[model samples]
Structure formats: structure tokens, C-alpha cells
Target: MSFLCLHFTRNIHIHAFYLKFSRILSTQNAYLNRFVVSLRPLNN
Candidate 1:
């Protein structure tokens, strides 16, 4: 029973970590996209 509880908690932690990591990735992607858009006029 204790092992099951530990496993459940670990899964929750991993899920939360991935959620946070994905949020960071999406924010970075958005920033990169904006940067690219801003640079397009300069390239032309």
C-alpha cells in the first residue's frame, strides 16, 4: 500500500514537471517566432 502511494506521488510530480517544462517551451517558441517575424523585414 505504501509503495502504491509512493508511485502515485512520483507520477504526479513527473506530470507536474512536464507541464511546467512544456509551458516554458511554448513561451520560448512564441518568443522565437516573434523574433523571426521581426527579422523578416530586415532581411528583405
Candidate 2:
């Protein structure tokens, strides 16, 4: 029973961590897109 609880909690932790990591990745992607867009004016 205790083992099951532990496993469940671990799953939740991993899920939260993954969500946070993905959010960071998305924000970084947005920044990179903005940077690329800004550079386009100079490129042409």
C-alpha cells in the first residue's frame, strides 16, 4: 500500500517537472522566434 502511494507521488512529481521544463522551452522558443523576426528586417 505504501509502495503504491510512493509510486503515485513520484508520478505526480515527474509530471510537474515535465510541465515546468516544457514551459521554459516554450518561452525560449518564443524568444528565439522574436529574435529571428527582428533579424529579418536587416536581412532584406
Best by TM-score: 1
Candidate 1: stretches off by over 4 Å: none
Candidate 2, pairs of clashing residues: none
Could you give candidate 1's per-residue lDDT for residues 1-44 as a string of tens digits? 99999999999999999999999999999999999999999999
Candidate 1 lDDT for residue 33: 100
Off by over 4 Å in 2: none
lDDT against the true structure, per candidate, is 1.00, 1.00
Candidate 1's C-alpha lDDT? 1.00
- Over 1-44, each residue of candidate 2 has an lDDT whose tens digit, in order, gives 99999999999999999999999999999999999999999999
Model 2 whole-model lDDT (C-alpha atoms): 1.00
Error of 1 at 16 (Å): 0.2
Clashes of each: 0, 0
